[model samples]
Target: MARVYISIGSNIDREHYVTAALDALAGWFDEPLISSVYESESVGFDGSPFYNLVVGVDTDLSVAELSARFKQLEADNGRRRDVPKFSPRTLDLDILTYDLEVGRVDGVELPRGEILKNAFVLLPLAEIAPTAVHPVCGECYQVLWQAYDRDQKLWPVDFTWQGRRISQASAR
Candidate 1:
């Protein structure tokens, strides 16, 4: 089985879609290693804030199959393909890493570039897989997060799944 990490986000009906994604993931992949949900300003476009998190799962399915599953899940949740890439989304899921495999495989890039460019991706990834090394950087996630210098901001939000509080919002 390959240890895979996926980044999930939703800007529309944040709680509903986030929870639904979690439910689907649990149902399909059993219990996953989930990171705290974060609220972040939309990066590429003007829109509502997004709830983002990372999920780790071990699967034997090939990368293409896995990507297809995630895309189908998004489509089921009302993802609109007609919208611009930076537009608001009901559900957005992207494969971040598949074990240590580097470069493109099965037409999907391994260790997605967003991991290093976005705080939303890196922070949760560090939280869940701190010791997991980046395929190209050769550094663990926690260290990368510590060294991250971008101004991209994100904060944990109160979130629950399956009757359990899985994330705590910062006290403001």
Candidate 2:
């Protein structure tokens, strides 16, 4: 199984949508490593702030399969692809890193969009997956994340879903 990391965020009914997505992900992957929820100001959009988090899941599914499932989760929670890029969303789940494998889909690379450029994805990612090196950049998340002078808008929240709990043995 490959260990994949995903960045998830939402600006509409964020807490509810994020929790539901987490629950859905647990049904698909092996044990997941969840990060704390962070509220951050919208980056490329002019709308409400967003709640963001990163999750690391060990899965037998291929990257394309996982991405498809994530998109489906977004659609199930009312995400609309027809809208402008960076538009406010009900749920946004992006694959940040998938083990050390890197390749392309539809001629565009994996981690295809600008999801990693935004600190909202990097901050919580650093918090949880600090030592995981960037597959493309070869830099640790903490070093890369802290080097950027991103606005300190992301704040932590205390909401988490059950059932996908990190195991005690795995926690060690």
Best by TM-score: 1
State the lDDT of candidate 1 residue by residue for 116-149, as single tens digits: 9999999999999999999998999999999999
Which model scores highest in lDDT?
A: 1
Q: Which stretches of model 2 miss by more than 4 angstroms? A: 105-108, 112-116, 163-172
Model 1 lowest lDDT segment of ten: 163-172
Q: List the residue pairs that clash in candidate 2.
A: none
Q: Rate the local accuracy (lDDT) of all candidates.
A: 0.95, 0.77
Error of 1 at 14 (Å): 0.5
Q: For model 2, what is the C-alpha lDDT against the true structure?
A: 0.77
TM-score for each model: 0.98, 0.86
lDDT of 2 at 121: 81
